[model samples]
Target: MSKVVLITGGSSGIGKSVGEYLTEKGFVVYGTSRNPENYKEGKFPILELDVKNIETIKQTVKTILDSEGRLDVVVNNAGAGITGAIEEIPEAEIKANFDTNFFGPINVIKAVLPQMRKQHGGLIINITSIAGYMGLPYRGIYSASKGALELLTEAFRMELKDFNIKMTNIAPGDFATNIAAGRYHAPLLDNSPYKKPYGNTLNLMNTHVDNGSDPNMMAQAVLKVINTKNPKGHYKVGEFMQKFSIVLKRILPDRVYEKILMKHYKL
Candidate 1:
């Protein structure tokens, strides 16, 4: 039997691309969306699920297990993006981002772990972000949420090792997707102290996403990792420089790397 796969936030963007690719490769794929009705034409079934909603997460997982009897792979791709100065960004928005990007994935994992343990084997792929490795000026909240997930996966992998369940993080750089459209942007305030710099950084961030590489690249990366027998704890997919930036952070002094980032963002 083909492996049964579940992808959160799969109605469109990276989740959609990964689901379609996995389906083509003979995997049984199901994607989730808050508004499944809007994606009636999607290639794979888009189940109703809101990452922030525990009940929906449970229902979606149960629905899949009832039909397929097993779920071999789960891609926790549901997340939200937030961009604003750390101080200026509302505390509520920050918490909301964490709910979707951090706690949400954890809830999904919890919902699926029992079934995976019963099967004695499964794979959990977390769709983290390259920004998670390092804090970006305006996208700090988004980075922190994904970074938390990355760390959580490290701990989860160790805990699930004996069950033959593998957990890994796949951090993708900017990809050409509708993420920018859905991201919450704190309004550029006329008198706020961060008005000018925040506005400029925000524009740069959107431009990067607009000119990002194809989402199919991330799908291909996901498939490759899934096929590996002993997958690494973390994998990154993106342009050379984007991936290299992570390495640079490791080798460079704190202030030096900070300078490079500041120059890049023209701050």
Candidate 2:
């Protein structure tokens, strides 16, 4: 029996590549996106969904379960980035980021758990970021959102162990994805308080994202997790620089690491 895996934000970037890889691996993949038709060539079934909407998520899950009979994996990959000083950001933007990154995944997980519990097995692969572990200057909003996901994954993993459900969080460094281009900036562009300080920093961050690792590699990493008999609680996937960054943070002293960050942002 082929496993059924569902991925959110599957229209592009890491999600698209993962969906493509898993489909090639013979899993019946149902990918969710606001515009599913755009990803038609990938051969996986695409379902229209916006993770922020709980009703849409529930309906999509119902459709998948009714048609497929079971789900083996759920990849919560539908999230976006928001940049700026926390204080300068609007409350609405903060909620929006959390809605998509944190609560959105929670909603999907909640909707799927009853079925997973009954099946006595399932895998949840959350697409988190290294930023979730370490905070950065202008990316506070984004960091916090992913940070919440890190804790959620841990707690859920502990709670679901008895049911034989597994949750793994992928803390990818910087993978070349469309996230930076689509990153939400403050809507109050003209009167933004952090406008002066954040201007060049945002550009610097975007440059790093633009030149980061290939999304396909991250996709392959996802496949590895899916195939593993006992997937790890977390995995870091990206270029050498990303791996180096995680290592350096662990080994370097506070001041030294601070200097490295400041130097990169030209502070």
Using TM-score as the measure, which candidate wins? 1
Best by lDDT: 1
> Candidate 1, residues 1-267: lDDT per residue as tens digits?
899999999989999999999999999999999999999987899999998999999999999999999999999999899999899888999999999999999999999999999999999999999999999999999999999999999999999999999999999999999999999999899999999999999989999999999999999999998999988999999999999999999999999999999999999
Alpha-carbon error at 56 in model 1, in Å?
0.7
Q: Where is the poorest 10-residue window by lDDT in model 2?
A: 186-195
Per-model TM-score on C-alpha atoms: 0.99, 0.94
Q: Name the regions of candidate 2 deviating beyond 4 angstroms.
A: 187-193
Q: Model 1: how far is 110 from its true place, Å? A: 0.1
Q: Model 1: clashing residue pairs? A: none
lDDT tens readout by residue for model 2, 1-267 = 999999999888898888888888898999998887776777788898998888888889999999999999999999999988788788998899999999999999998999999899999999999888777888988888998899989899899999999999998887788887788876436677667668878888888888888888878888889889888888888777767787898899989998998888777
lDDT of 1: 0.95
The whole-model lDDT of each prediction reads: 0.95, 0.87
* Residue 107 of model 1, lDDT score: 93
